[model samples]
Target: MVSTGITPSGIFHIGHIREILTGDMLTRAALDAGMEVEMIFIIDTADPLRKVYDFLAPEFENYIGHPIGAIPAPDGAGKPSEGGNYGEHFLSPFVEA
Candidate 1:
């Protein structure tokens, strides 16, 4: 089995692309060689928020050490919003792409 994991602490970036692509390429190569391969992508939504980033509102300080998936997403003003959880808010666009 080939496995890759990502922590949903912030925006997905180029480093994330590299990790996922590396796992995918490895899986493809193994499959092409007639090896049975299963690829798993793990999203670490349960990880805690470490701090309030520069882009985040000061109110996010209250969420420090709390699981990202349990906190609300940031609004346009960088304050917590009721739309969705923090982890999913950042991960959805990456998945869609």
Candidate 2:
């Protein structure tokens, strides 16, 4: 089994691509070599928010040290939105892509 993990503290970025793709490539290579491989992607939603980023609202100060998956996602104005939690909000697009 091949495992890849990412902390969902902020938005997905290019750096994340490298790690996830590396795991995927390894899995593909092993499969091509006649090995049975299972790839698992782990999202560290239980990780705490370290700070309020420039892209996040000042209101997020209330969430510091709290688990990201338990807090609300930021809206366009950087305020908390009703859509979903921070982890899912940032991860959805990357996973969909």
Candidate 3:
């Protein structure tokens, strides 16, 4: 089995893509060589909000110690009940791409 994950902290930067791509190439090569391989992509939605990111609003300061997934969507794309799944906000776009 092969596993690779990103925290979805904010942007899906090139460095993040590099890691995933590396994992994907390895998995594909293994499969092509007749080796059974399982690839797992991780999204750490529950990671805690640390310092405020430059792109974030001042309101996010209140959520420093909370789990990002438990906070409201910064862009108003979250549900009232779920507030927002922080990782989901960034992960969704990456997956779709």
93 in model 1: Cα distance from truth in Å? 1.4
User: Candidate 3: lDDT over CA atoms?
Assistant: 0.77
Ranking under lDDT, best-scoring first? 1, 2, 3
lDDT of 2 by residue, 38-66 (tens): 99988899999999999999999999999
lDDT: which candidate is best? Answer: 1
Instruction: Put down candidate 3 lDDT per residue, 3-91, tens digits, no spaces.
Output: 99877878789989888998999999999999999999877777898867877777678878788778766674322234456667767
Q: Rate the local accuracy (lDDT) of all candidates.
A: 0.94, 0.91, 0.77
Model 2: runs farther than 4 Å from truth? none
Which candidate's TM-score is highest?
A: 1
